[model samples]
Target: MRPFAYERAATAEDALRRHAAGDGAVAYLGGGTNLVDLMRLGVAMPARLVDVARLPYDRIEHRADGGLVIGAAVRNSDLAADLGVRADHPLLSQALLSGASGQIRNQATVGGNLLQRTRCPYFQDISKACNKRDPGSGCPAIEGDHENLAILDHSPECVATHPSDMAVALAALDARVRVRQPDGEDVVPLERLYRSPGDDPSRDTTLAPGDLITGVEVPAPLRMPARYRKVRERASFAFALVSVAAALDVSGGSVRDCRIALGGVAPRPWRAHRAEDALRGRPATPGSFRAAAEAELAAADPLPGNAYKVPLAVNLVAAVLTDLAGEAS
Candidate 1:
């Protein structure tokens, strides 16, 4: 790993002030699960690191208004175990549990997971041409083994999947990321936080240079019967091939409201808005789930090797819907 300067920020403002001093070459150090690994691999060579681990983990706080406030520094393990989060936002907890090993989870932070980089093989190796890794460089994955890459929101310049299970659930829950900037702080809708890789793959997140995620506010009491269904090559410590985060509000065996998000198939945690629209007011049955899944995958643009992901995404969404319906019973 390249030698880099490090500092511990006592407050959010201090972190920003120190970070701006280094300009874009500085990176906020969260749990150091992904970032540290990248630094060792020479994929990320940030000249300086601002330690945000000591700041504060506001935690998953249940509000009287039936919302959830999750602090940025909260550990993944802690977020998964929060009683209110576990009960109200089951999908979020489930997604967290479906991620990396316990050791990694114990250190990974909420904000860091949301901001994790893509897992594209080529992008990780500095030797290969990856637009996401370096601008003006080509993307080799387009002609390579893109089976595990992306099937949604992919551009010719880049086709890498955003590998965060927590992000998928957050997208489904319509959670907002609270970010603090030089002027002030504001909440950005989770869906808007990520951008599709269209020519400029280097810009992964929507957060400006100096912006730091403070915490995430989820307007919860999550329309009940939510689950995160993940499909992978193995049962443990592996990324999903096609994962689905689904929440359903069922009344008398019928869907009153629904929200669905897909991961491992896109550049970001994708909100299947059309599918949710189709499922609302419809019976929470396999037929309706199938139809909704169909509606969502219709616009999916799959590459040559990733066409299988289209069907896998559809099936996983339907299965999760079935699971949610069963739980409602």
Candidate 2:
């Protein structure tokens, strides 16, 4: 690993000032889970790391409106083990437990998970040609081992999938990120925080050079039946092949309201707006769930190697929604 300086900031202001002094070559360290791995691989070579893991943002607050304000530094294990989170937002808790291992979860933070880079092999191997690693260098994954790559919102420049299970649940919950910007604080919707791999694959998120995520604000719980289901090659420590985070409200055998987001099929956690639109007033049946899944996946454009992801994602979405509908009933 390359030599670098590290400093733990006592407050958000101190972290921001230190980063600003580094002139855009500094990275904020939350848990050092992802950043350290990238640094060792030489994929990321930040001149300095401003440690923000100890910044005064490690608490999870339950609001009066039945929502949550989760601190950026809250460990994944803590968040998943919180009784309030398990009762109110079971899907989020499920997602947290489904990721990594017990030890890593204990060390990983909410902010670090959201900002984790893609696990694309090409991006990790500095010897390979990866557009995300080097703009315009080329994306060999397009014609290489892309069995786990993206099927939606991908461009010629890149086909990498975002690897955060937590973000997918947050997207379904309509959570917003609280950021400490260079000038002031700002709150951005979770979906808006990520960027699809367009012409510029180098940039993963919409955060500015000096922006720091302090916390996430989840809206009031819908109290509907929700579920998070993931399909992977193995049982543990494996990223999702396809996953669904869904909530359904059924009344009189009809879908009253719903929220759905898909992971492992897109550059970002894909909000299933088309599926939600199709199911809002439809009968809560297997056929309706299948149709809704199909509607959302109609725009999928997968590469030859990963074309099977399309049908896999479709079936997964349908099955998850069907189960959620059953719970609602």
Candidate 3:
């Protein structure tokens, strides 16, 4: 790793000030799981490191509205094991548990997990051309080793997919992200945080350079059956080839409401709005689930080698919705 100045920040303001004092390439250190890997691989070359893990953003609090306010510094394992989270937002807890191994979960923070970069091989290799790493350098993943890349909402400049399981759940649950900015604080829906790689693959999120995520706010419990299912090459410590986070509220013999989000298929956690629209008020059956899944997959623009992901995602979505519907019934 390159030699860089390091400082421990006692507060969010301190961290922001320290980052502003450093050269433009300063990075906030939290858990140091993904950032350290990037530094070691020479994919990231920050001039200074501001340790924000010590900041007072580690608490998980209950909101008066029967929701949750999860601090950004809270560790992944803690969030997954929290009794309140497990009891209310079980899908969120399940998504966290389905991610990295025990050791990684213990060190990964909620904010860091949401802001982590893509796991694309090309982007990780400094020698290769990756638009996300070095803009205008071109993307080699478009024609090489793209079987695991995106199949929806992808651009020619980038085909990488976001690798956060927690973000996928947040998108499905309609969570909001709280950020601390230099001017003031702002809260935005989690689904709007990520941007498509349209013309600027270098940017993964809409957050400004100096902005810091403070916490995530989850609305009141759905009080419905929900599930997070992932399909990968192996059962443990593997990235998802296709994953689905779904919540269903059924009334009588029909679907009253539902939310669905897909991962491992886009540059961001794809909120299946089209599928949700199709499923709501529809009969809770395999046929209905398949139709909704098809409606969402129809917009997919699969690449040459990743056409398989289209069918995989469709099947996974259908299966997950069917299972959740059965549980609700």
Q: lDDT order of candidates, best first?
A: 3, 2, 1
Regions more than 4 Å wrong, model 2? none
Q: Cα deviation of 226 in candidate 2 (Å)? A: 0.6
Worst 10 residues of 1 by lDDT: 57-66
lDDT, candidate 2, 1-329, per-residue tens: 88888998888989989999997779999888889999999999998899999998999999998799999999999999999999998999998999998988999999999999999999999999999998989999998999999999999999999999999999999999999987899999999999987899999999988789999999998799999999999988999988999999999999999999999988899999999999999999989999999998999998999999889988998898889887888
lDDT of 3 by residue, 99-122 (tens): 999999999999999999999999
| Stretches of model 3 off by over 4 angstroms after superposition | none
Query: Number of backbone collisions per candidate, in order?
Result: 0, 0, 0
Clashing residue pairs in candidate 3, if any?
none
lDDT minimum window of 10 residues, candidate 2: 320-329
- State every prediction's TM-score relative to the real structure: 0.97, 0.99, 0.99
Better of 1 and 3 by TM-score: 3
- Model 1 residue 201 CA deviation in Å: 0.8
lDDT of each: 0.90, 0.93, 0.94
**Model 3 residue 189 CA deviation in Å:** 0.5
